[model samples]
Target chain A: MTGSAQPRQPEAGVRYDVFHTDCPARDVVDHVTSRWGVWVLISLRSNDLRFYELRESIQGISEKMLAQTLRALVQDGLVWREVEPATPPQVTYGLTEFGRDIGEPLTELFDRITQRLSPRNAG
Target chain B: MTGSAQPRQPEAGVRYDVFHTDCPARDVVDHVTSRWGVWVLISLRSNDLRFYELRESIQGISEKMLAQTLRALVQDGLVWREVEPATPPQVTYGLTEFGRDIGEPLTELFDRITQRLSPRNAG
Candidate 1:
């Protein structure tokens, strides 16, 4: 077989291909755009948080889901999971540089969304 | 009796309050920030689309979910649904001016997200 493989087109007429089921981009989108993912990134923006703290910051997120979500984000390189060798198995989580950069815009978007719906300023 | 009901506190530290289960913002977030909601808004950014057309544009979204999401968005004033009095129930769905304005920023966010994760451009 010749070493040339045909390339597939990106979906939705955008250069991004998250719409495809087999695309790795789908996983990234899931990690970054999920309901908890959105707030998790927002909560981690300005500070480092432990696993439980992250769960606390994002209200109503179950521990199992939070751990799973964080694991995926860490694998995707948007989140860093640090485990300090301590008696209590201390683990802290924070955003990577890429996460920080990407998160700023996302947080801004969230801010705009909230502001638009604010009762005091509702349109 | 003098009416003096104290205002309830919004959830989380942010000025916006989707973190609360009871807040109406949760419903708005569910509709606007959902997996399908993200793409739906992006799809409507540049054009008006009919109900079926929207379903076709967003891959993998179930028709029931899309109908419900669109209905909620319309109620929230983020989308405009027009039902023409005609045969076969010709219904058109499009963004309101408010939707258009909100969608611009959201589309921009999706663009950045896709760009950041592009295989050739992966960090």
Candidate 2:
């Protein structure tokens, strides 16, 4: 895990180190835990959604930020974008298997934070 | 959960809404999940550490960012800061009960992401 500068070798039992500046995990962590990323993942955990539906569910996110966050998640392969062929083609977003794996913990984290900060729990 | 502009009343069981712009939970989420905050929490989860020790453990964090993140965490009551009276004095940071509660989920999230992004798992 120390200074080998070569690409990660998972087959050799090398672990991806997030503390390393060049690790790909850093990028994934940034995208997944990002402001909009957290909410988007949480929203999609229960159901797939259209762009506008996600926007409405998230309350105050701007359309641009939502679009950007979705794109990033899709690129990272944590989200899948499906386009249906129809008169008015439909575009929907859902978490991929990997996305769901990551999303579960994030959802739990969100619930915990919300619970801790809830009015009843606030001290 | 809909448009109520009044300050939160915890005794009434009103959950703090992260989706709402004015919710205090939103602020806490922004601080705790901020780029540096996640790593900081994960680093401190195993054991308490001094400011310099944290910076060292986290690899690439800047001094200003670390200081800011710690201050925000402390303000949110998730982290406890203890200063010992010595020749130069010593300051150590550790998770408060609430901080550990949140940190566990975050640590899980981090491990999951790292495992997913590892070269062996990357697809």
Candidate 3:
């Protein structure tokens, strides 16, 4: 915030500004790039899911961590969190347009890195 | 390891195969996505440096963590570790071709995410 790095209001609706130290961008990076963040992005890549469904698919994430990661993603506008006023409170989580766009590239990167680093090459 | 998820052999130089769960890819992901891994990648974006130089650029990393992270990246073939046969044995680290290629896109993504999530728009 102290620096001259002004926030970018790209394309009217989208904004990206991380140069400043105090920007909320740092928080978003911390949340989205967190240990659970990468997995959450990959999990949500295929389809939408309810709270519990997401919890189950991610394998090792605790409910608290999942919820926290989701909330952070929502705040960053990278994820959509919908709440239905149905009988039992049915909620679904899915990727926003921005989040969806990131899927292909991120997935490709993940796939490549994982593939190249397989254990057999350790020797 | 039980499945037929054999590792890939590409270009007689590069390999990538991530469908398997037990592959070393998982370990690489764990290391690179660690709290410090992302920063280390970004730090290495600039140039090669001595061990201490890398340790200083990353701000809050402990010496142990830096060494560990570098070792992991080196093991994955994404980084090269050079040791000098001098009096005190000077060492330098730099990215491999694969690592360098990943920089542009990864840095672009990091910059965008960091910029967009700045706190001013958090409301």
Q: Is candidate 2 or candidate 3 better by TM-score?
A: 2
Per-residue C-alpha lDDT of model 2 across residues A31-102, encoded as one tens digit per residue:
988878888998899999998899998978999999999999999999999999987998899999999999
Question: Per-residue alpha-carbon lDDT of model 1 for A1-69, expressed as tens digits?
Answer: 343343543343334465655556666766777877877888899899988888777778899999988
Question: What TM-score does the first chain of candidate 3 have?
Answer: 0.75
What shift in Å separates residue A53 of candidate 3 from its native position after superposition? 2.1
**Candidate 3 regions off by >4 Å?**
A1-24, A115-123, B1-23, B115-123
- DockQ-based CAPRI category assigned to the predicted complex of candidate 1: acceptable
Q: What C-alpha lDDT does candidate 3 achieve relative to the native structure?
A: 0.69
**TM-score for each prediction?**
0.82, 0.85, 0.73
Report the number of the highest-lDDT candidate: 2
TM-score of chain A of each: 0.82, 0.84, 0.75
lDDT of 3 at B100: 69
User: Whose DockQ is higher: candidate 1's or candidate 2's?
Assistant: 2
- Model 2 segments more than 4 A misplaced: A1-15, A85-89, B1-15
Q: Summing lDDT over every window of 10 consecutive residues in candidate 3 chain B, give the lowest-scoring window.
A: B10-19
**Which candidate leads in DockQ?**
2
Superior by lDDT: candidate 1 or candidate 2: 2
- Rank the models by lDDT, top first: 2, 1, 3
Candidate that would win on TM-score: 2
